[model samples]
Target chain A: MKKHIAVVSGDGIGPDIVREALKVLFAVGAKFGHTFTTSSYLAGGAALDAVGIPLPEETLDGCRNSDSVLLGAVGGPKWDTLASNLRPEKALLGLRGGLGLFCNLRPAILYKQLSDACPLKAEIIGEGLDLMVVRELTGGIYFGERGRTDDAAFDTMAYTVGEIERIVRKAFEIAQKRSKRLCSVDKANILNTSQLWREVVKRVQGDYPDVEVSHLYVDNAAMQLVRNPRQFDVIVTENMFGDILSDEASQITGSIGMLPSASLREDSYGMYEPIHGSAPDIAGKDLANPIATILSVAMMLRYSFGLQAEADCIESAVSKVLDNGYRTADIHTPGMKKIGTNDMGSLIAQSL
Target chain B: MKKHIAVVSGDGIGPDIVREALKVLFAVGAKFGHTFTTSSYLAGGAALDAVGIPLPEETLDGCRNSDSVLLGAVGGPKWDTLASNLRPEKALLGLRGGLGLFCNLRPAILYKQLSDACPLKAEIIGEGLDLMVVRELTGGIYFGERGRTDDAAFDTMAYTVGEIERIVRKAFEIAQKRSKRLCSVDKANILNTSQLWREVVKRVQGDYPDVEVSHLYVDNAAMQLVRNPRQFDVIVTENMFGDILSDEASQITGSIGMLPSASLREDSYGMYEPIHGSAPDIAGKDLANPIATILSVAMMLRYSFGLQAEADCIESAVSKVLDNGYRTADIHTPGMKKIGTNDMGSLIAQSL
Candidate 1:
């Protein structure tokens, strides 16, 4: 396979981590008879500092031309005082919106070797956790009409039939790929947005006849995620609710540095990234963890480029490295050796 | 002091549990130099069966006439098919709305003895979880404009400055009574409703000069709740977020059956109940936990009747019974005796 992957080493430790992710990708390619062409681009705070804009035209062009895109963490306190439209995080919203990345897949998986690092009990973290959250990427309250006045403020959570249908269809398809169990979460009892969401999801359910479908109130789903996450397979929800729940789900996996996510449009191209933010506090300190970014590359290969064998190779290498107790500062266990960012990335590449 | 308490033994195990709560109230009354006048009312499914409506005219009359109201669990599957206006859950909402109960207080407290039952690790669970979530009960998305259309649907998350001011003031007052720490949670980074919410909360902070105030985006706050719950003292948020977070917080106490909540108006009158709904599956089976309902009666005494000593007596009895390993079916641990609902309620009252 020959693939062109656009790389956005965003801000803070992004540059260093992306270097390691690229290194791993090259090493995997050399060993697996695959060829990857890498192209670097500007994004987030770094882009703003260089060109007075977060997502530069050249950067979007680079991603649009690639087979897949890999982004490191973006945004930080440095951009906190910037105007809302100019802030580094706005770049993320722009890229997702511009690319029509409607399906955001955030899988919260607990690696058996890292179970001890989880905040949850051993019993609750039993066996291993595997659940994918399919969040509608570009719609809902996140991009809905919002306004404020001197006395009152409003934000509309709006969903069109077409929007709901596509997201629910993607959810059922993901369920078909996994355990064939789908849970559509909403607040149907109260919100009409939710009522329509439920109705549309039910309509989509008929198409995926082999998949088992269930519905849960968003509140109850949040509670159940903590109470027993094992019960879920493929969970789908609206953008804002998914934003919160997906983050909560990330925490269950022990370290945000170990989680990766994919934002995709229907064109078989996607953006992959670690589900972490720019850690300015530890930036330039060589303390960042690169596993999440490396794992993101793995997802790019499998989901975007359709190089399944190469992706599995990278995933297994990550598992083996964890099995051998190689730990980064964030996921360090009592007896595990804590290595710096580059060293951890090098170890995973070596394992690959 | 003489206090008149209106007790609404709702449905399912409501009557059985209220029998014990009343006994505890009487026991506390006997210990303190207080006299109590009790009145009973019908509500929930029981009320529908007896009076043809969930909240009958007589029940509302009783609630209006009493100093405070103590309600047992309400709603179950039996009323699932009832007309929306006559559903048992509506009775609970009607009571809150009719009484102008705008501030809903749900305290998440983890008894030292019950910490082992929590899903999160002991270190994350921390010493004792004692944060009070003061949720705005009557505003925000919960009561916002909602509807469905042929091709789309929407719900407005709306908030008025006056509404936020009152709720924030109530939260600050509650924080002043607690550890003097308050966290105002919202999605100010994304939603206009939250931006106004943040601004209003900040403006209201001037009134509470002595209390420490902090702002957290709701997504970050949700993650923080699981990562480090002990960091919070008093959390205030809009309705929908509060409903979800409060339930999540309650689960950290091990069993949902152990959490009590109160919906109050500024006049000091409130409707008290456990956060758990009626368990129709075990409704008549005597398997429900009554400690939460019993503890709610304690809150009614303290916050409504101003009988602090009586409330203390009830609380100490609950603590003492739990200290002696009195486990209700819902919170049963290995080797702990699983007592029936009535037995557990009676045991706590007897301890009082």
Candidate 2:
């Protein structure tokens, strides 16, 4: 198989972590007998430094021409003073919009080796939690019309049948691959948009007859996430609820530094990245964790490249490294052998 | 001090719990040399059963004539089949609207004796969790205009300067009484209403110069609640955000049966109730936990009746009862003295 990968190593530790991820990817390519070509594109603060824009048109074109995009973390205090539209984070929004990415997949997996870091009690965690949050990335209140008058301000939360149908179908498909359980959360009892969301979810359930579906009010859903996170398989919600819930779910795992995320459009074209932000403080210090970025390459293999075996191999290598007691600075324990970013990457690649 | 209280014990365990709370209230009245007049009103499922409507005009009239209202849980499976307008929960909504109650106070308190029930790690819950959520109840998406087209549905989340000012002032006053720190939660970076909310909160801060104010986005706030709940003193947000966050905060305590809430209007006039619902399964079986209702009585005394010492006495008595290992069926554990609703209430009142 042959694939073209666009790499956007944005700023700070972003370049370092992305380098490690590329090392692991190349190792996987060699072992799995695949030909992979990579193109480095300037974006975020890196682009702003070279050019006067956060997201250069040339970079977006490069990503568009590639099979899939792999992004390192973006933004830091260096670009915080810029205008909102010109800020480093705007590059992310620009890419999502330009690529038509509508679904964000955030998986919160509490590894057995890291169970001690979980905020929840052992009894409540109950054999560890591994659930995916399928968030509708490009719609809902975030994209809705908003304005302010002299005395009042308003924001519209609107949803169309088409938007709901696609996200629901994606969630169901994801659920079908996992535990066959999909919990669709919304404030149906109160919001008209949520009522329509529920209606469309039920309509889409017919397409995936094997997937079991359930609905919970947003408030109750938030409570349930803390009360029994183990009960969820694939939880899906609109943009704002997902933003809130996905963050909550990630925090409960107590290992944000080790999590990977994917934002995808309708096709297999997706951008995978680590959920953590670029640590400018640790930049060039080789102290950053690259596991999240490395695991993101695994997600790209499974979701974008459709290489299940290759994805499994990368994941297994990560587990093997952890089993051998190798740890990055962020997740290092007392008895663990703490390694720098490059060593962690090389170790996982060597395991592969 | 003379006080007129309107008691509406709705359905299921509502009557049982309200009776116990009234028992405690009367005991306080007798011990504190206060003249307390009580009138029982029909509302919720009781009103629906008696007059085929959830909120009878007479009940609203009774609440209006009284200084404050004390309500038990409302709704049950029996009334689930009723029309939306006639549902038992409608009674509470109607009272809030008719009485012009715009501020909701939900306190998530983790008792030291009940700390074992909390789901969060001890470090995260240091010194026991005690935070208040001051929610703007009467406005925002819940009351905003909502409608559906053939292919799309939308709900408006709007907030007026007056609305934001009143809630912020109420929160500041409450914060002034407690920690003097108020954290206003909003999606200010995205939504226009939240931007206006943040603006209003800042404008109101000048009025309360002694109170410290901070801001947090709703998503980060949700994560922070699970990560470090102790960092919050009083959190204020719009209706929808509050509805979700307050529930999450309460669940962290792992003692929903022991939580009480207050809905207040402009003045000291307010309606106090337990945050729990009518447990149809436990109705009339003497299995209900009366602590939440009794605590609601304590809130009423503090917020409405201006009887701080009396409220303190009631709170102290409840804590003393818990310290003595007297547990209701809801919060019961091995080796604890398990008691029924009536006995638990009597014990608390006796301690008072």
Q: In TM-score terms, which candidate is top?
A: 2
| lDDT tens readout by residue for model 1, A1-352 | 8888899999998987888899999999999888999898999999999999999999998889988889998899988999888889988998898788999999999988888767788898789899999999888888888888899999989999999888889889889989999999999988898989998988878899999999999888888888999999999999988988888888877777899999989868899999998898888788999888999999988888878888899999989888888888888979888889988889999998
Model 2 chain A poorest ten-residue lDDT run:
A187-196
TM-score of each: 0.97, 0.98
Tell me the spans in candidate 1 whose CA falls farther than 4 Å from its real position.
B284-287
Cα lDDT computed for each candidate against the true fold = 0.87, 0.93
lDDT tens readout by residue for model 2, A278-322: 999999899999999999999999999999999999999999999
List model 2 lDDT by residue over B164-258, tens digit each: 99999999999999999999999987899999999989888999999999999999999999988999999999999999999999999999999
Error in Å for residue A16 of model 1: 1.6
**Candidate 1 lDDT, B1-352, residue by residue in tens:** 8879888888877776777778778877777768888899998999899888999878888898888898988887888898889999888888988888999999998888788878889878667788899999999888988777798998888999998888899899889978999999998888899989998988888888999999988878778877788999999999998988888788767767788889988878999998887777776777778888888988888778777777788888888988888898778899777788778877887887
Of the true interface contacts, each candidate retains a share of: 0.79, 0.95
DockQ score of the complex predicted as candidate 1: 0.79
Model 2 lDDT, residue B261, Cα: 94
